[model samples]
Target: MGTITQFHLAFPVRDLDEARHFYGEVIGCPQGRSDTSYQDFDFFGHHLVAHISGEGRPLQSGRFDGEAVPIPHFGMNLDRASWEALATRLKAAMVAFHEEPHLRLKGKPGQHVTMFLFDPSGNALEFKSFDDPEQTFIP
Candidate 1:
């Protein structure tokens, strides 16, 4: 792959300290510059900023592979090993999963392992790994 560009996302969180602990300690993202109102993290090479706000968007659900998934979630697609490692880490930390880690789309073009969870501020995040990386965009 050529020079992949990093994406930036700024989202709301209820508290800075809670965001710090979750993104830094639980998720293992190296923190960047931060202040009383916002915190930045290196989310798998992408830039993620957690800004303090009263509350975030309301929760909604959508269906995927016969499962209910939170709408408007964000996350990264990792290789198999990294995905498994993160899953193990989250399990050990006892983070409540919005959707348990499991393989979906079996025998299909985009077969993959996936999991979902919410941050302390209720922002949904998903982590997944395609069985065949090349099939990431397959319809």
Candidate 2:
């Protein structure tokens, strides 16, 4: 069997402290390393670093998939149960979302349930799950 390796991703945040509170306190990702300009978080089984984008300014986002999705975003590929749990967690946090968690492309071959969120930096991230996991790579 093949193994999916953990990965690392970084994005811009307006305030490092806010990112710390969101990712560390709210989202509950463990802290990795940090400095005055940036902080690293253990996101699921991956690493996410939030860095200051120069001056204190809100991060910009883009529209995609019928929503104002953040352009520079990243997230993990989670299983069905974990994906549902994360959606519950996000709702409990009262996190303002760009797109709510829902089944996308109903009746389609790659039908999936996906949710979009933003970090403290306004960077978009998505966590998705498929009813048939093996269909993830179906062409």
Candidate 3:
């Protein structure tokens, strides 16, 4: 409704070069400021920083709408075109999907197209889109 604010998230990674390649090359995020220990990216307009923290932690899972989704995932709500294009790009890059691209909640108020995947560091990410953007927050 008003000016949407951008988000900033910093997470750990096993290696920096791996992260740079994945975020910059695979995900198509523009690289930002960085040093040896940390780097930043324009993650779908959000400020996402990957910090060097070896291996990080084991991922957990939770059931959502009959699907077992990664417990601690982060991602964006994109437009349909962008969501589909990214899905295609990830597939072409051979990124293993946590949840393959598909429609969810069909005919429901919250129907959406979504896909899930992990970065090289094993941090899970989800990207979704809705025909009606307001469906993103509907009850």
Candidate 4:
């Protein structure tokens, strides 16, 4: 009923080993019990799974607020200060963004700042923050 407490997401990846390296090694997500067909990751604080889909596949993305944004993606909401700090941290870490940190609904209601990133498994994760947290559920 608040900022999402936790979530579970599964994405397709061509190689389990590569996915393991990326999620578990590069991004520094904690590893979880898994099998050959799939692997689980303790993402920040959520449960994320990567399954062996196939090879040579690319996820289609679109544009949002002057930046290329990923479709069919999922992410979490953070408090304004946390979101700002995360955007700063991602930039400092040289993390590539499908959409740079900026308010999405420019010239409209619920104009919240957000950013998007891709995992090695080709899943999109958006981190969003709102100036007025109460506006979060406004119509």
- lDDT of the candidates, in the order given: 0.72, 0.68, 0.71, 0.68
Native-to-model Cα distance after best TM-score fit, residue 119 in candidate 2, in Å: 0.4
Clashing pairs in 4: none
TM-score ranking, high to low = 1, 3, 2, 4
Which candidate ranks first by lDDT, i.e. highest?
Answer: 1
Poorest lDDT segment (10 consecutive residues) of candidate 2: 1-10
| C-alpha RMSD by candidate, in order | 12.1, 11.7, 12.1, 11.6
Give the deviation of candidate 3 from the true structure as CA RMSD.
12.1
Candidate 4 stretches with Cα past 4 Å from truth are: 1-68
Estimate, for each residue in 6-97, the C-alpha lDDT of model 4 and write its tens digit: 45455667788999899989999877646656676878877566666655565344333355445446776677777777888899999988
Residues 1-139 of candidate 1: C-alpha lDDT, one tens digit per residue: 2222344455667777999899989999888656555666877777566766645543255445677666556777677777888898999999999889999989977688989899999988988777876555333
- Point out where model 2 deviates above 4 Å: 1-68
Over 1-139, each residue of candidate 2 has an lDDT whose tens digit, in order, gives 1233334355778888899899989999887546665676777767566767657565454332344445356776577778888898889999987779888757866467888877897667877776765544343
Q: After superposition, how far is residue 39 of candidate 4 from its true place, in Å?
A: 31
Residue 55 miss distance in model 4 (angstroms): 25
Better of 1 and 4 by TM-score: 1
Model 1 RMSD in angstroms: 12.1
lDDT of 2 at 90: 89
TM-score of each: 0.58, 0.52, 0.58, 0.52
